[model samples]
Target: MEKLLTIKDVQEHLQLGRNRVYQLIKIDSFPKIKIGNTYRIPKREYLEWIQNNIGKTVFL
Candidate 1:
């Protein structure tokens, strides 16, 4: 099974706030899934995105 991350998890992992995470989610390149009203991020894809976008400043 794939590991899933919640908004709070993303916040902690990225050292960002809740609203910042939500803002990132609005960006087209952000890797996220919306199920009902909750947002879930796939750990693998999130990590991949980070690796691929290293040094790129994400403005949100």
Candidate 2:
């Protein structure tokens, strides 16, 4: 089964602040899903994003 991650999970994985995560989503680059007021990200999507941005500086 595919893994689903919460905002906190993404923050922990990326070691970023809550605001930064939101900013990434706002920029439409981060893999995220909005269910009402909550945000969830698929583990695969997060991994893909990491791979896609590899070698680039991710300013958080």
Candidate 3:
């Protein structure tokens, strides 16, 4: 099983602000899951997305 990351984890990982993290989540291709009112990102998928989207702006 893979780890699921919270918005704060993502903010720390990407060195982004809370609003920026939420903005990224709004992008259609971002790897995320919604559980109730909380959002969780799959660690593996996020890592893969990083590798794949290197040098590209992810927020839309």
Best by TM-score: 1
Candidate 3 residue-wise lDDT, 1-60, digit = tens = 999999999999989999999999998888999999999999999999889999986545
TM-score of 3: 0.92
Better of 2 and 3 by lDDT: 3
lDDT string for model 1 (1-60, tens) is: 999999999999989988889999998888999999999999999999999889888888
Rank by TM-score, highest first: 1, 3, 2
Give the Å shift of residue 38 in candidate 2: 0.7
TM-score per candidate: 0.93, 0.81, 0.92
lDDT of 2 by residue, 1-60 (tens): 888898788788879899988887785788887889988888998899989999998764
Output the better candidate (1/3) by TM-score: 1
How far does residue 35 in candidate 3 sit from its true spot (Å)? 0.4
Error of 3 at 6 (Å): 0.4
lDDT per model vs. reference: 0.93, 0.84, 0.93
The clash numbers for all candidates, in the given order, read: 0, 0, 0
RMSD to native, candidate 3: 1.0
Tell me the lDDT of model 1 at 33.
91
The TM-score of predicted model 2 comes to 0.81
